[model samples]
Target: MEVYSEKQQIRAAIDALKSKNLTLGLVPTMGALHDGHLQLVKKALANNDKVVVSVFVNPTQFDNNEDLVKYPRTLEKDIALLKTVSRNDILVYTPTIEDIYEGNTVSENFDFDGLEFEMEGKFRHGHFDGVGTIVKRFFEIVKPHQAYFGEKDFQQLAIIKKLVEKHDIPITIVGCKIHREANGLAMSSRNTRLKPEYKKAAPFIFKTLKTAKELFGTKSANKIIEWVEKQFANHDLLELEYIIIADTETLKPVKRKSNQKSYRAFIAVYADDIRLIDNIALN
Candidate 1:
């Protein structure tokens, strides 16, 4: 597998493959490699002639400086993990901060319709703008036929879809299923920071979501939200941040279930300083 740090060289390498009429798939990631990320790579490899997996931890995406500093970086381990995925030369792009941000590192402002004003956006100001900026940059740099993203970041996935639609970017955005641990906790790079006991309690987040899903049609959305709030309220280790039952398309919180629209239960929890988010479809 050929690993590259420079954008120009990476683009040249991709262009070489494209010259032979090879189809390309791109999987953009912040490094701390795990099975969840590899699943994305596996999906990309299955679909395209070649794949480019980027492992740059984007600074613009983090609203909290501490979270940014504390965020794990395992480039060597990441490369080793990528190697285990396939014998095929997966083009691994690990750009430096200077490569991605150049001199001005400020995030570009984007209007994600009203989608930016809810959930993660409300909590992390300018977060989606960073996401939109970096993602758009990757689209420009990689120029792949199709790009893969996991559905774990459901809101981000929606924003990206909106981005592609609004800009008319010529690429298919494939949302893969959320990868989870045996305990049902959603996989995240931040999972690395969880303390031992917090890690043990982490699976409760998914369990609560599952229970909430079961209560969906029987109870009102607001009632279910109350119940979930209570569940996390009583938990010693995990603290609930926000929970919303929203229409899948618009992401506006719904008071009651509608047969006409699909809905999902989205939740954010904090195990001390480490934040974890998870969602489940409640159709």
Candidate 2:
């Protein structure tokens, strides 16, 4: 496994691989390697000749300074975790903020076809712009044949696909399944900040999502939404942020379920200070 912090050297290495006709896969991540992240690496390795996993906590992506500061940065442990599943050709790029952004850390404004108008976009404000800028930068830097992203951030996955389409980037954006703990809590870097009791109650979020899925066809979207809200309202530790049943493609909230249209139940919750989000497909 080769680790690099310099962009030029990494690009040179990638050029060498390309010369040999190697198919490269990229997994862009903000480091705090859990089994969920390793799963993405494994998926990349299974499909490509070589894989590059980036471990930089992008400042542009964080809307809140406190959230950015509190975000986990376990690069040493991240590298060790990667080593467990990493092959010889796996390149871990640990670039500094200066390396990624040069002198400026500001995000580029992007039009995600109004896909950024709801949910996180409404809440965080300019959050997707930052995500778009950093992701676009990663695509330019890596120039990989395929890039992998976990579907836990369902809306963000949609935005990224749109990003590639709008730019006409010749790269496959692969969406992997949302990985979860044995207890059903969706795996997130923020999970590290979860307190002991909150962690114990966190699995309730997934349970609520499951129930909402079960109620999809029989109950109205609004009914399911109401039920999910009520479930969290009674919980002692978890506080519901937003829960919506929306079409999978357009991401518009659906009042009535259509047989022809696919839908998903998306939920955001706060286990005290830690904000976690999860979604389940409802067909």
Candidate 3:
């Protein structure tokens, strides 16, 4: 249940834990806790001798001023949720802007040219760079043997995996399952901002993804896209952003599959300006 706000304290804490030969696990978060985030913590707890959950709201990831201004911040409630799970949990230090980025001499930014321009990245300019920069910093500070991320952010998970591999950081990255509500909408902090009616309809995203899965191999990529598009068009509140049926791993839009049987259907939409994203695997 210990909370720290200084780098020196973080170093000392990790150093002390390392002295005891503990296998450390790091769960990086942005301060608002939900079932999805807790699943990550639970995984880290199971996999390591000690688990550290960081509650820093990284400033660099937001693409809009309004989004940043409106992003939820419930540090006390978040901390309480973590503490209730376990008092022995390691909470990482959260540095202020002055502490994190001191001057023009901050660590070099990730290139992220290819990674940043796909999926959510294409929509949010410099978003992956912000994700990459802070993730790199978090790993550098925590130095955990392993890290856990949610599948809800599948693309971000993919980018972070590539980041670790490219940098040769000695850590295992694990992607946990996406947590969902009874109605099937993926749990996210942003879900809080949705209007009451739109909140109820949010589960339709997952349902549409389910529909994509059911219709996957029966038709060509274009056919699948058309069918999904029509389904989305039926919902007046859900405005389709993009519906892409692409390669399972590469994420490139698939025109024709030669031997690639596996596919992923990624979609984005706005329900009264609250952007929602989701993807499903189909083979």
* lDDT of model 2, residue 145: 99
Query: Considering only N, C-alpha and C atoms within 3 Å, which residue pairs clash in candidate 1?
Result: none
Candidate 3: residue 246 lDDT (0-100): 68
Ten-residue region with minimum lDDT total, candidate 3: 104-113
Tell me the tens digit of each residue's lDDT in model 3 across 25-88: 9999887789888888888998898888887777788878688788889888888788767787
Which regions of candidate 1 are displaced past 4 Å?
Answer: none
What TM-score would every model get versus the actual structure?
0.99, 0.99, 0.94
* Prediction-by-prediction clash tally: 0, 0, 0
Question: Pairs clashing in candidate 2?
Answer: none
Better of 2 and 3 by TM-score: 2
User: In candidate 2, what residue range of length 10 has the lowest lDDT sum?
Assistant: 80-89
**Model 2 lDDT, residue 209, Cα:** 91
By descending lDDT, how would the candidates be arranged?
1, 2, 3
Candidates 2 and 3, the one with greater lDDT:
2
Q: State in Å the error of residue 117, model 3.
A: 1.7
Error of model 1, residue 243, in angstroms: 0.6
Cα lDDT tens digits, model 1, 41-153, are 99999999999999988889999999999999999999999999975759999998899889889899898898988889889989999999999999999999999999999
Report the lDDT tens digits of candidate 2 across residue range 1-283: 7999989989999999999999999999999989999999999999999999999888888889999999999988998898899648699999998998999989999998988987778788889999999899989999999999999998999999999999999999999999999999999999999999999999999998998888986889988888888888888889999998888888889966779999988889998999999999999
